[model samples]
Target chain A: TQLLEQSPQFLSIQEGENLTVYCNSSSVFSSLQWYRQEPGEGPVLLVTVVTGGEVKKLKRLTFQFGDARKDSSLHITAAQTGDTGLYLCAGGRGKIIFGKGTRLHILP
Target chain B: GAGVSQSPSNKVTEKGKDVELRCDPISGHTALYWYRQSLGQGLEFLIYFQGNSAPDKSGLPSDRFSAERTGGSVSTLTIQRTQQEDSAVYLCASSPRGGGLTITEAFFGQGTRLTVV
Candidate 1:
C-alpha cells in the first residue's frame, strides 16, 4: 500500500508567523496535491505538483515537490487566522491515498 | 461552474439503520469519486466511477458500502446497517478526466457529516 505521512500532526501559530508542513512517503508518486479544509466542510484544492523539484506559489502560500516525488511541503508566510484549517497531502496516482492531515490553528 | 454538490449536509441515525448519500458532480465531468473522513482514520477513499461504469471499488471497507452513478452525472453511496464506527464526513469529488488513470485536480463538495448513534 502507498502511504503518505504528514508531520507535526497539529500546529498552532500566531498571525504573521511563517510555518511549513511536510508530507513524506517511501513510494514515489506521479503527482501530489495539497488541500485545506475548514471544519464541517470538504477539503479545497490548493495546488498540484507533478514534477520533482517543482515549486508553485499562490500569494503567501508556497508548495514544493520533492526531488524524488516521494515528499512535498507547504509553506505559508505571514500567516493569518483565515489560514487555519486541516491541511492534507495526497499522493499516488493523484487519485486516492490522502495523508493524515496536519491540523493547523492560526491565532489572531 | 456550479462545482460539485452533496445533499443532506448532515445525517444522524440509529445503529442498524441504512442511509444513502448523494452527489451531483460538475457538468461534463467524466470521473467521480467517494471518500470518507473520520476522526482518526483521516481521509479514506471508498470508490470511483467513470461515466456509468465503476472500474475501482477497492476502497470500500465492507460489502455494506456500495455506490453507483447513473446518467453520467449523479451518484449515490448507500451504507447499510449503520454503526458508530461509520460516523464521519462522506465527501464527493469529480474530475474532468484521468487520461492514463492518474487523476487531475478534483473539485469537492461540502461533505455530508454522518453521525451514527
Candidate 2:
C-alpha cells in the first residue's frame, strides 16, 4: 500500500508567523496536490504539482514538489487567521493517496 | 450540480445494522471516488469508478464494504453489519477524467458523517 506521511500534525501560531508542512512517501507519484479543509467541510484543492522539483505559489502560500516526486511541501508566509485549516497532501498514480494532514490554527 | 453531492449528511445507526451512502458526481465527470475519514485522520481511499466501471477497488476495507456506480453518474456504498470502526465521514469526489498518466484534481462533496452506536 502506498502511504503519505505528513509531519507536524498540529500547529498553532500567531498571525504573521510563517510555517511549513511536509509530506513524504517512498513511492513515486505522477502528481501531487495540496488541499485545505475547514471544519465540517470537504477538502478544497489548493494546487497540483506535476513535475519534479516544481514550485507553485498562491498568494501567501507556496507549494513544492520534491525532485523524486516522492515528497512535497507547503509553505505559508506571514500567515493570517483566515489561513487556519487542515492541510492535506494527495499523491496520484493510478489512484490518489492522501496524507494524514496538518491542522493549522493562526491566532490573531 | 456545480460540485459532487452526497446524501444523508449525517447518520447514526446501531451496531449490526446496515447503512447505505450515496454520491452524485458532477455533470460530465467520468471519474468518481469514495473515501472514509476518521476523526483527525487522512482520507482513506475506498473505491474509484471511471464511467460506471470500477477499475480500482483495492482500498475497500473488507467484504462488508462495497460500492457501485450506475449510469456513470450516481454511486452507492453499502456497509453491512456496521461496527463502531465504521464510524467516520464518508466522502465522495469526482474529476473530469480518470487519473493515471493524466493526473486531474478532484472536487469533493461535503461528506456523510456516519456514526455507529
Query: Which candidate number would show the highest DockQ if scored against the true structure?
Result: 2
Query: Pairing residues by index, what is the TM-score of model 1?
Result: 0.94
Clashing residue pairs, backbone N/CA/C < 3 A, model 2 = none
Considering every candidate listed, which one attains the maximal TM-score?
A: 2
Give the per-residue lDDT of model 2 (tens digit) for A1-108.
778999899999999999999999998887888999998899999999989999999999999999999999999999999999999999776567789999999999
**Per-residue lDDT over B3-90 for candidate 2, one digit per residue giving the tens place of the 0 to 100 score:** 8889999999999999999999899999998999999888999999999898899999999999999999999999999999999999
TM match of model 2 to true structure = 0.97
> Which docking class does model 1 fall in?
medium
Candidate 1, position B43, lDDT: 86
State in Å the error of residue B28, model 2: 0.9
* Residue B44 Cα positional deviation in candidate 1, in Å, after optimal superposition: 1.0
Question: lDDT of all predictions, in order shown?
Answer: 0.89, 0.92
Candidates 1 onward: DockQ, in order: 0.57, 0.74
TM-score of each: 0.94, 0.97
lDDT of 1 by residue, B1-117 (tens): 588999889999999999999999999998888999886446898888878888888999999999999999999999999999999999999988753535487888999999999
